[model samples]
Target: MPSTHNPGSSSPLTSFGRSIWSRREPFHSIEADHESSEQELELQSFQKLVVDLFHDLSAVSADELLSIAWIRKLLDVFVSCLDEFRVLLLKNKAQVSKPPLDHWADEYLDRSLKALDICNATRDGIEKIRTWHKHLEIVMCALESRKRAFSEGQFRRARKALMDLTLEMLDERDSGSVFSHRNWSFGRNNPRKDARRRQHSSGNSSGHSRSHSWSISNSWSAAKQLQSIANNLIAPRGNEIVATNGLAGSVYTMSSVLTFVLSALVAAIPCQDRALSTHFSIPQQYSWEEQKVEVEQELQELASICENFKNGLDPLERQIRQVFRRIMNCRTEGLEILSRANNLE
Candidate 1:
């Protein structure tokens, strides 16, 4: 035996003895130890890679190749990584089914699933950032377009155009298209009949009639005064001045005309009743009652007309305010874009 092997020297039997001793440890424990070692190594590698990338990015000049295309390329890389992460998560999830009878196995499975969940959450966050970046680009483009279309001069021109159009519409309304309906002239004389009678009269008769017209001159004078007031109230105000002052001037003119017309109507109501009473020989009490009814009806109709005008004006005002608000919002957004661009620069 002494000749075959020395006690100080190693032999194949010693290596076999070491192998047998290593097998004394649990197979599962050894596998877990190996897995943990691999995971630690991977984690360290990832950390080092991230640190190196950060240092490299920080060293790069800001003006160098940092375009939208670069961002898109980075996003493409993120997407690929996200897809790979998803596959890993799916595999981990499949492995998590059916709780293991062993408590350690169950805990390991739970930990694996938790890690997968964290990875999934990270992927979702990256996706959101990408989406937000895309949306930001769209908003920037829209702001640029709006800034081009709604410059200060263009806004001023648009406002002037709106004022001109409004004035034109008001002129058409005052020209008898809106307020000079047949119903508005219900008690006025027939122009055709008056003309025919005047034509039939001789020249000498016309002169004599004018001399004797003093008897009914007061009535004619009152009628003429009322007609003149109506014409003045309905006539358009200074177009040149209104064009410079915009909607405020137009509104002021309309309000002033409405006030004058209301005052004139109030004064004319009693005179109109008196004229009708003299023409028709009804009992004095009945005449007064009928006149009151007619006056009330006329006032009600006038009130309705004012209400309609006000209703229409309210919508126009709302539309104008809305347009102004939109312009202001665009301006604010434009300013924001400019600030962001300056910062980028």
Candidate 2:
């Protein structure tokens, strides 16, 4: 049952081999070219996206800067960038788990986790504003300046509400307490249910699971949290870009964006332990850096505006109502974004 081949004789097998050899092309080179092409496309797309985002953000006027509406837009930009970055990771998952990239992904994820605390703190700040808003409502209702003449009792009620609001704000400032000790978060149905869920899911090993009902201690500092996020963040080198097919750059971009957005947020919102000094010096230059100075300017303006608002009761109700709406919208959007982040694998 054995077949033998003659050394000097050409058989049908020899002819078939020649035909197959003739049809063979440089498949390895072709595949390499295709992959290279795809990588370039992905890199350029991400870069363009980042550029566009910053450009749009920087285009805001000075009056709008640090306003509630502007901050809401900033959150929208962040969520969009986050979604795109997630897609990039999914597309290159094979390479994502490999050397260098895996390390970067882990670092980015840790930063994201830290960001969750800031988001929760900011929401608490919003809640505090909401409480302030209620007092403002009381003042507005008591005055009814537009509808009727003011009475002594009405004046007394409005003065009481103003006194209460001032005391509440001052108390928070004196205590440096940004978040309340009651332990709350966005997107939760019930705090008791959340506690039960945490207890039940205790055995699960997922890191993101703990973020659902995250709470901050009384001594927690927003400044320290921001410093922790900005710490050890470095831009990838040119060699790293080549090795990881430019994913390193995207990671750096996302990290920087996250840091900038958070820094600006802490600067604008009323968080506890308000040390508004976070150094953000990346090797690469970004357009968003200019916004830092703008944020600082806004902080100064806020202090002066508060004094002015205290003196002038005519526009106080309108201003408070507008800010309340803006913060509510931002809080709602933030909950949705954080929910998506928690679900990311």
Candidate 3:
């Protein structure tokens, strides 16, 4: 028979191709050709699958309000896809050594690596969100404690806690001093650092500085308002513990002032509505007397002011609730995606 194969050419696939070509057991040249075509088709299918996965990942990552839950969902998908892609790459590595197939494998691998990088970035973003969430929770808990103390008439405890919280917030506002001197020195210790490092550090510092300033301003304002109310309530001789027999008339003045002050405090602290039911604790022995009509009139005005403050907080509270709802929605969506991906796997 005439030679059908080239002997000088060193194509890697040539040997495998020739072996299949020389096969005689029902696998003829036509079958060999079909088999080679099938391998090419499989490679193309795998490449397409990878491309589609990348598109899905990119879409999720590009979302403006990318939450931790969403990122976790994407990371799960990427990890699964990467595992499958790596396996496919290995399977095809030995079976195919041709031009376009090899190129496709290499390209897919590169894209998979890029997806991993995105996964890492998403993880970092999630960590930052977690930190912020933790900080918010701590602030909420502190507010709750202060409210409880005040409601229970632990005036001194409430005042001290509020003052400590305020001072801590103020100290935190001085960002440069919040961290240890050693940590601060580490960043500037190397004068020989590249310009890119300096630029990046400066950019991050400036952004953090702005955020810290805003947070400090809000906290300081809230703290000052709370302190003013506390001072008014605990003023010398203003909040004396009078006898129940004399309380009807003697305590009426302090009680009215306290009622007004407590109402204002409740209005200032948006989360303390449940704790600050009715600010006054008139002794069971005495009833509301006509002698205190003037004090009641002033109390009514203060109540109106408190009502205004509560109304102002409604919009803010609504906005906060909306944000929480959005986060919950993201978490639900992520769980759904993860479940679907798990089913596929």
Candidate 4:
């Protein structure tokens, strides 16, 4: 179909031309590919600018969106951490591989908390949040350092997380009256609790545990319910949130048990000597050799129980370890992929 246009003649134009030039084409023909390429380049530039803006924000965002942006910076910081962790791990790889656990604990416990902040920031599905979470944890462990528990920088990193989390949670609540109220104070690691719990000697332990397992289980069961709801806020395999909350709940439950145990001990302290003397007749009735044998047997039993829980917790340990491993892998792989992809980009 050949239609010819003379220099002074006009042809009916398309809707596009009408909008652009009121029924007239600006040029007789246009090169679409070149224009489209320019547009794509411009879009790419905008995206890059946004990413750079986020990078600039990392420095200032610590006071505001600490967790989310901090996670973003971790892409680099964690690389530094991994190098340190690898060096420490090499020295202790065969000697002691326990450093991996601290890294695992950080993500499995601490990192999940960071995920909560990100989840709030993004308000995305559990799976998406969880994917982000698992990746970060795995990567962080690669950075695990054996240098005095943690490097000063790592300590600050964790401290920032704690402070941010505390402020976020407390900012929502009023602690009621000052005279009789519970105040929350978070610090790096469970340092204070660990120190206080260590102060109590094994010899001081009460032989009486809670008489009923039902009551102990009930407390954990209630905690699990609340934890599940909170954790579900994360997307797709985002269940790490649930597991972290579970661990925190367990820590809280342990605290409750410790409180109960301490109250019992304080109440029994005055009568402890009398009770022991009444039952065993002390040095007169039992020889040092017999006492040693009894203590060693108790120690053996305790060791067996610890081993049982470590090696065979029915299903709970397996469930926990599975999530722990996912989080660890995700963090490591995510960063590795990012570095490579960024290079390509």
Tell me the TM-score of each prediction against the true structure. Answer: 0.17, 0.61, 0.27, 0.17
Q: What's the lDDT for all of these models?
A: 0.29, 0.57, 0.30, 0.28
lDDT of 3 by residue, 194-263 (tens): 3323453322322111111111222232234334433422211211212111111111222222233223
- Candidate that beats the other on TM-score, 2 or 3, i.e. the better one: 2
Judging by lDDT against the true structure, name the best candidate. 2
lDDT of 1 by residue, 1-345 (tens): 001232122433233223322321222233444554443333233323333332332232333222222222322332332233223223333222222212222322222222221222222222222333343333333223223233444334434443443453344323422212222111233355336445533222221111111122212323343343334232223442222222112212222322332222222222211121222122212332336456346446545434433333233222222322322333233334334544655
Model 3 poorest 10 in a row by lDDT: 207-216
Best by TM-score: 2
Candidate 4 Cα misplacement greater than 4 A, ranges: 1-64, 67-70, 97-345
Model 3 whole-model lDDT (C-alpha atoms): 0.30
* Model 2 alpha-carbon drift over 4 Å, by segment: 1-36, 147-151, 178-215, 275-345
Q: Tell me the tens digit of each residue's lDDT in model 4 across 286-341.
A: 34244555644654654543343333222321222232233344345434433454
Regions of candidate 3 where Cα sits further than 4 Å from its true position: 1-65, 94-122, 145-345
